[model samples]
Target chain A: MKKCSQCQNNLNYNCETCILRLSGKTLFYNVPSSLLQEIEHVDEHISINTKIYEENESNTYLYSITKGIVKLSITDASYKTRATSLLTAGMSFGLEVINKSSYLQNATSITPVKVCKIKLAREQINESKSLLENTLKKWQENITNQNQIIEKFSMGDTHTRIIRLFHYLKENSPLEEKNNFYLPRLEDISSIVNVSKENCSRALSKIKKMKEIILVDKKSKIYKT
Target chain B: MKKCSQCQNNLNYNCETCILRLSGKTLFYNVPSSLLQEIEHVDEHISINTKIYEENESNTYLYSITKGIVKLSITDASYKTRATSLLTAGMSFGLEVINKSSYLQNATSITPVKVCKIKLAREQINESKSLLENTLKKWQENITNQNQIIEKFSMGDTHTRIIRLFHYLKENSPLEEKNNFYLPRLEDISSIVNVSKENCSRALSKIKKMKEIILVDKKSKIYKT
Candidate 1:
């Protein structure tokens, strides 16, 4: 049994016995155990900043995050990079399998990450009721989450956006205890919230001074007070 | 058999012969003609500023726009309303049918609108491969489109955001000629682009002064010169 070096968890690529599935925090949670056991997947431990997939690349597999966070972004027509989403454990990306189209965003791991990659053919998905249901459900949830995040950041000043972003991270983190969670790099946070790194740093300091969040371990561990 | 009062076009609720189907610009385009013939749908003519659906309401049916535009927005935690999407003809909304969940945003008619509403059950979608395929494809496109809009708007200042918003609207409008399109009210445009109405108007004036866009007919018809 190989162990995941990043999270130090014993790694099993099988879906049926996976810890994320056991904890009921995976995209396949609704899938029946029998079907889960029949599914074949590969688990990969990705180092920080590794490119999981590139925009416009051929998307052949759907990826489910097992540990750590991944930033999904795209370089727009103006050559500006904007973060579209931050997917953590239990969420999935590379949903272009449904359309068999190219990836629309570049996905890169923001932390040492573990992902379960499943090659889900469109026909295979259409054949399995549970899998199709779960896929569409995740797709809907992803859109809703993105919309909410955009709404949150669009409504406030830089500091307010930073505060809302932290609150959002705290709410979405998969940790059993939500008091503490891994914070992505300042650059990643600034990109996600559409603010400059300096502005984000200033906002973070203000938030800390206001006692909203406590950053420890050189800002890696963020605690919501 | 009836006429759509909003667009002044002949209306047919049947999926097989609908104009949007022939134009290949609808969510159900890929469904088989046999299945399309069997599907029952309703055509509705909605007045301007009408609330099509409220956020968190039970989502039972999916709506395909046949004419005009609709705005999708949500009130954030701070009670500020943020527009998430602006859907024009041939686009669809109320996608929560996939999960049988509540609507995630409040959808309102930005102009006199016509929609073909379909009650799509999850089992019905799973039973038909093409319908499921089309639904998933639309879902993927919707997310991609939303992300691109967010990315484009996040790149620059208020004027830049408004310009990007118009370019987006021009690209998305289903008119046969893209040289001109209906510009939503300043309030709607401001909300959609995350700027104040005053700021939006000021930016529009600057754009007009630079001849980037020509606003005509009481600022309703916007022409790209």
Candidate 2:
């Protein structure tokens, strides 16, 4: 079994705090603790669906989630929102601050989110090797995720895309189950998959009939083999 | 009149070598000359359609083209390729070396490509502040490009996507042309627009009928107003 996020115990239980401590995959992962301590930070609590930052507008602060999910998205000229990626605990948002450019995507709270907002400074990034490395690492990870999404869309029908979408959510979410887990609401899933709500529902039903997903609740389910 | 790539004079000639020196928007921009000179580098010549590197596999050397075009693409499970971005002169490739992970996109030479391949060494990166800064800058530029792509697809129809593709190419190229430019094969345009070849052809014909484009040669054209 894979190691647990919190205690590394390899047991199934809701360990929400595990995501916070196991942020080895985040920007703070390899940074010097002293530097982290010296930085200015604010603890922010946001309601579900709250807008954290708008694309190409905000650049004052960088953020790291301690609880809940933040979905990074982009809106076209027509104001069509495309879900770029999901930011769970340990993932840092507002990373474009390093380049001192405009935000590339919008950040929105997917659930009730708790985040630590840090004042962004170029000096901090210049002096910290670990910080720069982690930022590049995250950028690389985002690129990989984008390619994977493109891959899914390029080859799959609606049903296949929906299955991959669920697999994607489970992969990004905080772990608590072996085969069973909860997901964002259908609308969120539809936004990520870039399909209509009806199409998304149809795909979900198809997956259910195929015995690929066992419904545990309206938003929770099992990835049945 | 637009400034020439080499002499800054208004001219109407192809400057094949001009892009090599005019790289203000690339990673090498703002970097010290001595640091660049100290690095071990090799000049490589790639034929058209040569595979520079495959996505999710190659991580051998970092590359920057001096001439021609390199298209970054992603191939799905069914081996269908979608062009993600164009890496022109000054723009670099093989950046996944920073993350020490798999490549996020395939780098394919769309023309006869002149490239400088460098073996990325961590010691060199850690010691030079310039290298790290340039890399970060490139990452930020890439994020911006990705957002632009998302914006284009999300907002516009296929015709607009084709127009934006041309605009994007003009923006990234070395020289500024007011109403004329050469393009890659229709297949390349089709790949970039994520549309079928017949659809791309239909869009091209529509634009031609709309007097937005004037056919010159098979690959060269005039963007008529």
Candidate 3:
């Protein structure tokens, strides 16, 4: 494991504290300390820019964001793509690889990013073992969150839906100041809410006019009033 | 655990072959045989006419159907109830307990139901553990099926929605069919499709006229043509 030079931090990732703050549970809770030690030995840090996983490609490594943001997305046959969700510092991705051989969604870094990659073949992690139960629980939460989004789309009107999304971000986003929680690009937000970009733009305009939310830096950042 | 006297059958809640078939690769592939042995010990058998869990009551058990059918429903304040899903032999229920302290749905035996009940106190059988990974995979599949139902309601027109429900039942129902599977009650179908009883009735009439489905035993049962 890469240790911080000054503090000699032995952990594989820095986001554990932030993750615990957001989830009230750490991903490494059930992980055996010995196994963590083993992981620390083999963990490698990689830096990548822009597109990371190619379409229809199999992801061989599980990644945790160490520095910047990663965007997860899926594309249709018509080449229309939607951002599924976003991963940032301290968050993990490529969990869908646990059940399937290939990655179902594409992940790309929003900025030059640092990620700690763990090779699946390096460790014999059993999906059914208690050693990884915490990880499984994390995945289960992800699935539930996805389901909730589906429910919101199903039950809520457009304005209600947008408000629900805002509420969700406010509740779950790592940033404490509502204004510091940077919103994804308009296209990414459109894909997540299952709205056309024009509709998403219109909805944002309405929300801004109503003073429910404010935009900053030419609409790249968003904050609640 | 209950055992059959003559056949020496271990009365576990899951039919081994049925679980393997239904869960397919999702849960079956990575599960170790030793983990399966642990699951076999956790099985509890209950007889017919038994109430497993009541609506709004604290949920304490995760059940799998080993022998007979189970009727899962929810009751409102007025005691007006609706069946959500009819879990047949080998299907699992009582998953609402995962996120909540109580059950949202009530479960009762439809036939001489034999269930393998996993008690909440047993830390030995962690649902997130590798031993029950197959079981969790099956549960995720159930969630996916639920998502499809929600998608149907969100995106499809009424006629198309009803057709999708029919198709879903035809694909997932466990009942044996010479020509077509029979749905025993309108209320059960209505709940699954998220349609009103009246709408289900009207849709049935339309489908019958289209020769897409036929009713059996008045309105008590239905079969696709």
Candidate 4:
């Protein structure tokens, strides 16, 4: 873990400067500078290798991915794991605690990662009314988009579903072009789409042949075109 | 539609009196009376047979269910319809448009309904920024809850999914011990679970036999003991 030289603070997540750089064009565009200062006190740094949150454990802090990717996944009574979504730099996670007592899923860092943690209590949240409202608004928008993705999977055919997913990723990507995207592991994608690994491979191959996307490797990489 | 005798305004959605009655012991108990007044407004009343919004339509208003039930649903490109969730008295809907250009689903009155519609770009929302912020916070919480339900359907078995749904209703319902609840048609429930009508019926019957719940009719009803 690295520490901030100026404030002598352990720096695991992005510094305020880094957040300004990554999210400046998107969600951070309209946030007032004074409001950013309010967040400064709440930020704490963390570093994790590979797996992070354990299943069925209490989660007390929310994290913003600063330098790497994290996978949020859930397991059933039979111990079958299903990946729900992926969080990368500039995205937030661990908000399920607002509705439930404990984390329902396990979140693991897909790579060696740095995350900024914000400790929140209900009373503290109630005090920072405006900031809390703004955060909740962003959270709601993210969940709505996720629900739409689930709806597509439930209703659309495989080809249509893949197309929809591609479009969604392209529209939402921080990158300039869909073809230049950073893809997650094939297993993670398969878990999200609820398809067998073999099926996911075939689907990817089919799409690749059509020039819809390009796969860099059979496992952990892809580039959409 | 009946009008409020006190103000001669259309009495639909939750009136101030109704809200006071419902807020007795819920999470909303501490919401200030002045804040409630600030958020309250007259809304149009719609009959149960009327459709509040159509698939792919541009939704321009946000609504709070006051007197009856509403169903939020969507149709695919092939015109297959699915109910995403049901909203009852005291719950709000149509918030997906907050940051989007248009709505992703259709909302309809499941029973003769009264809904207080908020004009997001005009009215009290603009004048009272704090009130608006609070409203958005509550709306965001609702969306988060909806996402959890979607996640459950995507990952859990039919039985577990049903249990989760029942638990959610029980926890959120305004009335305790009166677990008898009203919902849309059985086909609507099938759409939400992404299962065939026969499969949904079988699942419900299985749960009923297990003493988990009882259906009062083939459509438009459900109850948990």
What local lDDT does model 4 show for residue B24?
A: 41
Q: Taking the tens digit of each residue's C-alpha lDDT, what string does model 4 give over B1-225? A: 667533466654343446633564222234456655655345666765468887667867677666666767767545666666666666667665554446656787755666667545423333444444444455545644454445655345677766665665555443334665544356666766666678778887888899887765455454655
Q: Where does candidate 1 stray beyond 4 Å?
A: A2-9, A12-14, A19-24, A167-178, A205-215, A218-225, B3-14, B170-178, B206-216, B219-225
Model 3: per-residue Cα lDDT over A26-85, one tens digit each: 344455555555553233333333566854588676666655567666664336565545
Docking quality level of the chain pair in candidate 1: medium
Residue B117 in candidate 1, Cα distance off native in Å: 1.2
- Tens digit of lDDT per residue, candidate 1, span A117-206? 877667766656777878888898788767756666645689878777776666655455666655667877877888878888998888
Q: In candidate 1, what are the lDDT values of residues B101-160, reduced to their tens digit?
A: 898888988766789877777777765766777788778867876775566664568888
> Candidate 1 or 4, higher lDDT?
1
Estimate candidate 3's alpha-carbon lDDT, on a 0 to 1 scale. 0.54
lDDT of 2 by residue, B1-225 (tens): 444332354533222234443445555554566666766665666766778788778566887677667888887777877776776776677778866777778888765666767776654665566676677777666666666666674346789888887766555543354544556578778878777789889988888898776655454333433
**lDDT measured at residue A6 in model 4 versus the true structure, 0 to 100:** 34
Q: For this target, which candidate reaches the highest lDDT against the unseen true structure?
A: 1
Q: Give candidate 4 regions above 4 Å deviation.
A: A1-35, A41-60, A65-89, A95-116, A119-133, A151-187, A196-225, B1-29, B43-50, B54-61, B66-69, B75-79, B96-104, B111-137, B151-183, B196-225
Query: Relative to the unseen true structure, what is the C-alpha lDDT of residue B67 in candidate 4, on a scale of 0 to 100?
Result: 61
Candidate 4 chain B, which ten residues in sequence have the lowest lDDT sum? Answer: B20-29
DockQ of each: 0.59, 0.51, 0.11, 0.20
lDDT of 4 at B44: 69
lDDT of 2 by residue, A46-114 (tens): 766678889879567888777667887787677777776776677677877766777778888765666
- Deviation (Å) of A72 in candidate 2: 1.7
**Per-residue CA lDDT of candidate 3, range B1-225, in tens?**
657532356754343544643464423234455555554324455544467788668856676666555666655323445444556555666654544446656777643555556543324435335434554455545434333333443334456766765665566444456435455356655655555679878977888798887765454354755
lDDT of 4: 0.57
TM-score of chain A of each: 0.80, 0.72, 0.68, 0.65
